[model samples]
Target: MTNRFFNFNRAAPDARSDVSFTRRLVSDCVVTVGVLALFGLIAWILPAIDAPVGPEGIPSTVSTDPSNLPYYALRSVFRMAIALFISLIFTFVYGLAAARSRRLGKILIPLLDILQSVPILGFLSATVTIWLALFPGSMMGVEAASIFAIFTSQAWNMTFAFYRSLQSEPKELDEAVRNLRLSHWQRFWVLDVPNSMIPLLWNMMMSVGGGWFFLTASEMISVNNRTYALPGIGSYVEAAAAEQQPDKIGWAILTMVIVVVAIDILVWKPLTAWAEKFRITQSESTEPKRSAVLTLIRQSHIDDLLARILRPLGQFLDWITRPLGRTGSKWGAKPSRRRAGDIVFAAIIGILVIAGTAELMISIARTTGLAELGTAFGLGSITFLRVALLTALCSIVWVPVGAIIGMNPKVSRLIQPLVQVLASFPANFIFPFVVMVFVLWNISINWGSILLMALGTQWYILFNVIAGASAIPDDLVEMTRNFHITGWMKWKTLILPAVFGSWVTGGITAAGGAWNASIVSEIVSYGHHTLVAKGLGSYIAEATAHAEGMKTIIGVTVMAIFVVAVNYLFWNPLERLAARRFNIA
Candidate 1:
């Protein structure tokens, strides 16, 4: 029976064989139908549960009842899944485009840096009205805006991961590919993607965590005097906070924890285990990460059955792409044609930048004065200081903890999922509880806001540190033990250096996230009580709420400029230094 399940045999069949085949076919069909039915039910229920659209296209009502938590959690998960799928596609294309062309790479890489630095709140504030206008008097516009917000949260890091992987492809592998004359499509699927899979998976996990961190803000968006609460965990939490119901907030937190654990068990763990094969270093380690769910799926007859069913479609794709693979000409263009294309692209970009700058300047001049400019600059400096201090604090705490956890494979396997769940838990869900404590204790809003930003942003540092430390070779670890390396010496000579590259990556991401989190964290509210911190985030939030277009633009632009400048002067140099000094290869 095991052989029958594992082996694909086509030969003259006896009656017993025929009977077994028929039974297998029936089993496969039943499993497929059951899976489809489950997904179909979810799809059907989501629309039914969504609040009716109002005249202004916002949802008329959103339930905060604990009983509705399951449905709301499902809606949020579904939206995140959709956004993740879109992010994956974009990552592939954008990463490839930037990696393959020098001219495009120069342009695209910096563009990604700027895009990632642009606060999520900025994207929401700028695009929500446009999206609403596009799908007037319908929930579709709001849904689109929410999904896009999530996508912005998730996509940039994934793209950077893939692009870095491609650019850092081993010289020998690059030579082999050139010698083999692999087609562009073939190279991507067979070489680039598989080679990049490990880091890409890790970054993808981080991106999902980020999506969840900001999920509440995305779902319960307030922009330009308009508030739309989508039926999701985010909106549920928002409603709970608004009602000042600690019990409901607790329920939402519990529901989110359960949802996150379920996703890890069913999706991420299986994918992580499966991606082990794609690791570029073929050296066998002492112990590999294991997943019971993945093992069970692999051993199941359904796995073989699905492979058999999908084999024909896979074959058809190969057949259609065969001609392209055979012709190397498809991968190249004439020098003259390439030069012309570059010129045209540059011209278009230049025109757009000039027009955008002119329009922005005109708006700023018309609506913003010297006083407003000074206020924005002052508020921005306050936010910048908070980001810097918080990022440093996170690095100091998590780097050592992450290094310790990562160096122990068994402990890491046990604890990583829990950490990820914590990382993904929306900080906003606990705002009511936070408000209660602060109100009772009379704590400063500024300090409380800093703590909130830390909670939301520190995971980037922790997870990246873990990834880096986990990648350290067994040989290096054994050597360290042989030398009796311990304590601060061990950290300095072995662990810290090993994880430096990852630390830099994490710090950059964490700082960017901190900047983004400010818009929500700097202003805390529960029912009639509100605590406003003095920062750029509060400035932008206030501007957005009042529909002060020029103020919002000025705040967003100033923040973006600061972020981009820091990246260029500080993070970029540190990244290069880490790559040069600490990278194992």
Candidate 2:
């Protein structure tokens, strides 16, 4: 009887095991189906992009109906995703190259500054023709132009963050790479990239928000009185605003909130949880971070199967990189040979830059005169005053607030998604209301520009501060608490010094953002009343709107000059100070 009972139990257990296997198979199949559906949807989108342009040859048409919101959201998200991928690639190549060698950095760094300082519409005005030429009579051209504009807004922020993080690399890590016989290429991929992961992740989020801020301008723009629009959330907002539909505007904001939350849950949370492992600590964290998505993937058979399929590709990359990592005999071996090579490289770059400058100057002289140049300079000076004061004001307000938010992990996690949504909110949507207020009160755009610029740029400082403060080691916080360090001394000794490097980074980018925001902020339009500020931003805006390429170039050049001067006179020295005074690693 006992043997028979045992046999029955064993058979029942076997049946349950079989049922579990069947469920696992079904789960894997579901994952497979979901992935295929995603690809199918992408395939659907490709045809829409490649379709021939309508008679207008710009926007075609965008529907503002609530039912169409999902499609528009998807389109905008897709463009954003593509731009982000391009920006990531650009950040890696440009930031690494600048950080790798001093001689190269002298040229690349300033070029990056100039590129970032150029306003969004300036880029649109300059690059739109080229994109149209590349894809003549196709919507692809308009789409490409939009993506390029978004890339310009995003790529710079990430590049700066990556470059700054590389600059702060620990000496010990460098020594280890050398001791491990890792060459320059190997060190970059294996050591440098990993070390900068935290900063890169945070800055990438900031870059996305920055791109979203300009999405409206990218999607719907007017050049030389020719209107171009696209099918996206940005275009939807533009259309609704034109019709003065407050309900539609409210709906758009609600949709934007949904998208932001969805992205946070589906993308950022998993990445953030995974990045926790990269934090520099002497021991494993006592409380491990968790992500449902990461956990699900870990348990999924599909992940392992895909990894196996991609193993060969991974190995090929590793193999290809190994040889490139080798140092040339002349590099870092002899001082004279290295100096000679550097001089030759510098000379070649200088010749190219001079040639470009000569051509550009000739064109500028033909299309514009010395008077135009003088006018631009005067306008730039005014904008410069506003940008400087506004940046200072933002820093003063956000620094301590960011520090407080950062130091509290519980609060940081709770509020970070909300911050992302807010930062990503398009200031263009708020312009009408602001302009209405100005019109009612008979206020000038010159004074109102301050609020607009601050609205757009202040988040840069806040985000950077939170990133810096969150990185403060737990032991340090505990030690300060043990010593009863509080009030001004605590801030002076612990908080300020800890976040100094981040502040410098934030301040530089915030200043750049203000310069860019000035393009829209300096010029506002409501139903009938248009307020224009007497500044470089309005100068550039007018130049771009008229399709006066030479004038835009002049405006950009003057802006770059101001930015270069500010960096040299202020930011560079602060960067050095942070490195020497606070860079313990």
Candidate 3:
């Protein structure tokens, strides 16, 4: 009887295992097919989703109406997803490049600074004409432009997260990876990318919010009286703004708040928690930290399942990343030679790009008179000057205020979300109101344009300062407190220096954003009246609207040149200065 009972129990193990395998296989198939089918359907229908109509038979923007709020919300979700995709690509590439070499880092950091500083308006001003021309007389062009606009709102923060995380990775950890002999691809996919996730996720959340702020301006593009409105929540709010419908605005705001709360609760909180759990305590000296999501995951069956799966996945990753691991390159003494080859290749590529652009511009100018190109370039320079002055002034005003807000954690938390909302608030959302206010108050168009340009990029400084202030070492804070440091002296001696790096980073990015904003800032459209400031943005905006082949091409070319040059001359030097003075790494 005992033998029979033992045999029966032992037999159950093999029998039960087969059933579990079948169940898992079915579950995996269902999940895979479901995901694939859903995505496939979305892809099939996306192109046809334009200019939806209401029950009244009037074609609404992008086939969405206020009455059909769910559809509008879905459109916004789709747009944000696209932005996230682009951001992830750029962030990963930029982050890896920055991590590899200090020289590349130097060039990239400044480049990103300029890119981030330019406003959404500026980006639209430069690109819209080309997009319209590229996809003329079709809804496709409008959709493409919308995607590009979303890219601007999302990419920078992710890049910042990746770059900063890579830069701040512990030295010993890097050494350990080197000892592992991982390949470059392996190292990046396994070590660098995983390490970047926490910060990247946080930045992505912020980017989604930022995209919301700019979505309206992105969807509603007007250049030189030519308007191309795409269907999205941005357009909905924009239309409401035009009509001054306070009720619709209120509804939009309420909806936005709910969406933000839902995202925080359902998505970001859960993902952040899961990532935190994987972050093992590598040091006993480190203070204890609690993650609610981690706690939940720890007690769940899902965690057990994931742990089981990860054992093999981890081994696979280690094998793949072996080439990039610290000792991997040292198998032979040719790494230095290989690195030299990389440098040479990069230099050659850089030269080729410069030569190509120069040749292309010179050819265009030769065919169409250098005088015409020069005239546009000259006007662009004037616009550039205006942008610089405005950026400087705004920086002066906001940097101090940002410092104050940064120093106080409680104040920073309160102001941070508000700043984000204001920063993301679409330029068009306020353009109508600003126009009316300006007309009545007799404000000059220049000032109005400056305000628009300043509005979009100011958050860079505010957020950077806050980040820096918040990151001030706890020991340092205690020291200051013990020493009775207070007042302006405290700010000058402690807070200012502490946040200086963030300020520079933010300033560089803000400066770029301001330049972009200038395009929109320089050009304004009301019911019938359109004001064009005599600068680079207007120059591009006008060229973009004409869609007459040469004007558009020339305008884009000249604008890129000026933008690149401005960064090289101004932002690059400042970035080097900041890094030298403040880089803890």
Candidate 4:
């Protein structure tokens, strides 16, 4: 029976292998050619679909007509492509940094949370000045800013997914990597990236919708109504909204839904299917090969060509990293040496701060009085207050619910995607309705703004809580159950403490988001009537509109300081506590 199974020499080729290589190659080539041809056809036809057939002929540009499906479709495709490329690069960098070193990861991971918390509008306003400065006397400035805006919406979720995967890689998997003696690059390319794809794909799907939430800001360039519209879906949507054209708006919404579904079917589903095949455990399969794509790529002539080109580059990188490898032991390096590196990093940071401060001083002297900085700082403090208060409130509301849901795998399964959808939904889309409701109810615009900011930040806590709750050691849970622990007592004694680490992670992320969200929270919109609340976001928005460099820079600086200080003061201590209390010994 063994001989029969092992008779590879006499056995016929597998069913799929029966096809001649030439035929297989031709089929694959045809598929590839067909896909490219379809892409080209779509690209060519997309613009024409919405071409406005006026009295004379087709209009040069899209008008306020959602029936111009081609134009919006083209814009959607371009924007999606641009966003994906930017997100992929960000994920690679963030994921690599987080996985490479524990200390660096600690800072980078929390920083990611802070970055994600930042409102799309705030990001737009903050980056516009820099891009404009960089490409002075160019149309590319706004374009760059637009790309950056999309990046802000997409990068965080992907980064988070990659970081989480890196951090929580299975112990058995880790052992295999060590036993294999795989290089860092090999480990990342072969193991980490592949494992992260499932989560990353889901997150990318979520980002598509998240990207829409910020599309208005991303496409319709408006800083204090100094509007510049991109020839994109967002710009089209904004035009429709401005004209109160429900038909156009409806069309835009439908386009978005179609795009979302198309992505799910074509990209996400296929990638997820591929991910499943790669999830084989040690006991499940003895094969060294990974996924079909990876296997094919490995054997491809293109891969061979790339390997030949990259071999030298790989050697150079190894040579550079080789020196660093000798600095200390693998795990237990000298404290003094580690301290030296820390000091060097701190010194570099201090130098940058001092240099920046000096530059700011000179700029202040040239442009305005020193008093302006003080005024900006004071205004920014109000924004910080709002952010901190709102974040605390968000934690209170969402953390417990997240914990409960996280503990129940069934509930988590049902609601995780829903939570992600809610979290990613642009608060700006609802801003119009919120403004209207508040006006009708005679509620303050400040309260309305607060809610908008909270919308993005609140979900961070929930996600963290859920993750934390789910991560609680099964042994601990079983012990608790064995002892008949239940109700509030169960939560107090077991659940909270067990999931405390996750809570800290979530809180940190939420707080960071709140601070960023405040930039949007402090500014309110009610049609033609604009309400500027007493906060930093309002200040920054005002500064950005007028292109007030001093105030904007000062406001961003103040905001960063407040965020960093709060994290250091509150979150760091809590993180230490959680680690100490919940270390997986």
Candidate 5:
């Protein structure tokens, strides 16, 4: 009877096989075209990046026609893609170093705060000359500067998210790694990265928005009294605004929407779906993230074929990693050896700092004096106050809203694309209109700068908090239900502690971003009216405008000091507290 049953089952010729074969055939054709087109587009754009510069510098023409937007969008996307890759590398190296070593963490975490607060414009202006010297006659120099500027805007948030995630590494995983006696490298690959993946992906998405926030500033380059507006959606929007062409601005908005939608579909959604497997929750989400594109790729015979082709390479990696996994208790460096390495690292860093300080002092002594130092610090204090207040206001407004939205998966899915479009739209494009309204209201530009900075800064808080709230474990939710927990009691016990780490991540980035946004926000121009706020941002901008190198350096240095001080006193302490509370296990 059992033999007959086996024979019957085998004879049925499973219907699922027919459907699978059909789906595979269809997906194979689709994936083939997609891959070809992607590579072809990349091949076409490489020349544009490396094009030789003439006496006029890299060729950049901004066209008003809507038809050209597709090309503009592609160029902008390419720059963003390169920046994101660079940022990921920076995150891994810098964030991992800080997370693994307490001594390095003290230095790097504060340094990261300062870097994120430094204005994009100031960094670009200061470094553009060096980049130009490196690739004197190629567009690649301009391209490199632009990409690096975007990297500055994107990298800090991801690095912070990663560092925090590592600190919050679930105790369960730590025990498992210890049980297996994994090497540092092995633990990094297998445990640390997997644990950080969800938060990192969420931060990566937010970082893309951060990149767009500075797109205009990065794409439009000014050097030696000559302005070069690169061919990108950012420059396109800038041109439209310059010409007072509201119609063109409308078209740019439409193009931006399309580009944002494509990114959400092609990139973030698929990755979000795939990362679900790495989720730390013991109880799986019934309504896990789903991606149509990933599903299609999974159905494709082409994907399977590629996997089969790469199987040997994957196995080779595993084979090599095995030696780095476990033998006994004899792994990692000795205390003396580690201390020796730290001393060498500190020596190298100290040398760099001394050299930079000597050069800065010499330059300032040659140009300005002690009076400018006081002026710069005073301006920095004003800006610091604005950033602090604005960050607090944004937190109050967005934290609960983000938490509510994130707790409901259906709501998050529905609202995610809308938020993406809103976040991806550069608020700088609408600055003139906002300024005009403020002018009409007889508002104080000094204080009103807070509102403008909030345009770009608030989204960081919202995005991070949503990720934190969404990550709350299903078992925790069940526990809350079982206890009939609600209202402030639920929040005090379950919600706040769970999301505190993410909130800190958001708060730090938001505060840093507020400082960065001040460069564009603290000074505004509308027709015949130019309003300037009394802040470090305006100090830097005015200095840059007049090509006052010493003043610019002083203003930037003061801003950096403010950032480092604030982080050391406030954000770093909060992060440590959150880390202590973050472990789910």
Candidate 6:
């Protein structure tokens, strides 16, 4: 009799048989050749582009012609790809460090919270000069700066997602891994990563959208009378807006929409479907999502080739870490000594925090007087109100719509990719249209800024709600139907509670993103006319543009403090309530 627990299915044909091997080799060769050809094409065209080289060897000018749209889009996508790769690395290292050490997590978690709330504009203002100086005359410095800005936008939320997932790992699985005596490295790959896959993937998708939201600001680097435009869709849109050409703006928007949709179809959807298998639940998921691309890949000879390639590498890693696993306990200090070490670490952190706070206060005191401080606080209040009101409005609209879409699998499959594309649309690209309308209609900057902020932020709520709603168990749905639960009763009891955790998570991210978007949304400019709103975002933007280090730092520091305070007093408590009281077991 076959052992059900450890069956190998020996009846299957050998994957390394002569015919199978030949097919796998051919498939891999084709893939390799296609990738090389694509790279070659990019290399051939890059030098021919008409961007002007500066005395310092950097590209100082950007081409705005419609003909350059494809090249610009490709450059933007490449930067985003590099930033995403860097974000992933940061997420793993930082997230794992925080998760593994309770002592470290106390400082790391709150630090990450503050970092997330810090605006992309703040990063650009602080780091762009440094990056430019680092690279001297090369455009590589500008590229690095732009990529780093995008990284700030994308990395924090992913790190949070990974940390939360790791912290909430199933206790039974935790015990199982410990009993098996897996090394830290082994546990990370076999347990932590797999368990966190679904949430991490969803957060990663949102991070990509967040990166796009800041693309224009990052790529069109303008500060202190100097402007450096890296050839990208962001700069394309900015140039169109500057020229006041609606047709070119429309083209840019269209091109962006196409790229976002393609990425969703080719990358995110398949990854989401694959991640479903990793969900840790007591009852097996019923009729989980299916991806046509995933199915095609799985059935192809290329799959066999990948398996053969990865298998040896995976084995080699395990072998390399085997000794560490065996000798881990021998390397650790005794309990008393370890406790002393933790105390010393905590003391060091405390001293650093106090010193940093003191220095910041001294800097602000020297830079500006009471009037400037009062102005910053008052402007911060305006931005806060906008974020709060817009967040509430977005929740009201998207929560129900997301619930309806998520309840039906067919509808979800059709609409999820569309939502992703919408989320990933650079909200700044539509700023020209908004500015044009506001200018013609005589609308206030206050309301116009709110609308732009909402446009960039609402999709976070929508996508997260969909993910939560989709995870609702079939058995639970059947039970609700069997009980004839309907109307408000059904929503109050079933749907609302089911998606509460996700909604809170989405709200937190959306709120942070809105605060970041304020730097652009609060200060709208079209051609020669500019509308500046009374808010901290505008303050930061103005300060950044003038390269006023003290004012920029003060504005950013005040905004960060406000955001951190709100998160602690409001969002943090709400998240905890949702997790404890509303989450489905």
Q: Give the TM-score comparing model 2 with the true structure, all chains together.
A: 0.90
Candidate 6's TM-score reads 0.88
C-alpha positional error of residue 47 in candidate 2 after TM-score superposition, expressed in Å: 1.7
lDDT of 6 by residue, 1-585 (tens): 011111111123342344465555664566567568869866864553333447666544567799889888888888898899999999999998898777778788778777887888788877888987887666677888999999999998778778766766667787888877777766877778877676678788888998898998889887765677888999888887888888998989999998998888778987877676565555555556777655444334544445566667766776797876531244668899999999999899989989998987787788786478778989999999999999999999999988887777687778887888888888888888888889999999988899988888887788778767766767788788899999999999999998887787788778888888899999988888799988999999998888787888888888888878888898889878876788665
Model 3 / residue 403 / CA error / Å: 4.7
Give each model's whole-structure lDDT.
0.79, 0.80, 0.62, 0.63, 0.81, 0.79
- What candidate 4 gets wrong by more than 4 Å, as runs, is 1-62, 69-74, 98-142, 156-176, 189-210, 223-226, 244-345, 403-413, 467-486, 489-499, 583-585
> Ten-residue segment with the worst summed lDDT in candidate 5?
1-10
What digit string (tens of lDDT, one per residue) describes model 1 on residues 291-361? 76655444335555655776666556656766766423446689999889889988998999899988877
Q: In candidate 5, what are the lDDT values of residues 316-338, reduced to their tens digit?
A: 66568676556235556889998
- The TM-score, computed over Cα atoms with residue i paired to residue i, of candidate 3 is 0.73
Give the winner by lDDT: 2 or 6: 2
Cα distance off (Å), candidate 2, residue 88: 0.3
Give me the candidate number with maximum lDDT.
Answer: 5
lDDT of predicted model 4:
0.63
What's the alpha carbon RMSD for model 4? 7.9
Candidate 2 Cα errors over 4 Å, as ranges:
1-37, 183-186, 284-290, 301-306, 326-330, 340-359
Clashes of each: 0, 1, 32, 2, 0, 0
Tell how far residue 496 is off in model 1, in angstroms. Answer: 2.9
Candidate 3 C-alpha lDDT tens digits along 1-585 = 111211211123233344455554654565456558769857855866553333543223443345745556566777778778988898888877876765677577656765664556556766777876786556666677788888987898678757766765556767777777656655665567656564466456557756775777777776544566765667777777656565675566556665555555445545543443223233221222333443333333333345466656666765676555553464433778868967887898689779987997787766766676887788777777776777678668877777666455556545645554554454455666677677788788765787777666666666666555544555666668899998888877777776666666566556555666666678776555567777777766676566444555566556666667776786557655656666443
Per-residue accuracy of model 2 over 97-214 as CA lDDT, tens digit each:
8987787798888888888898888888888889999999898988999999999888887888889888988888877777777656557666677667766777777788888788
TM-scores of all models? 0.87, 0.90, 0.73, 0.72, 0.90, 0.88
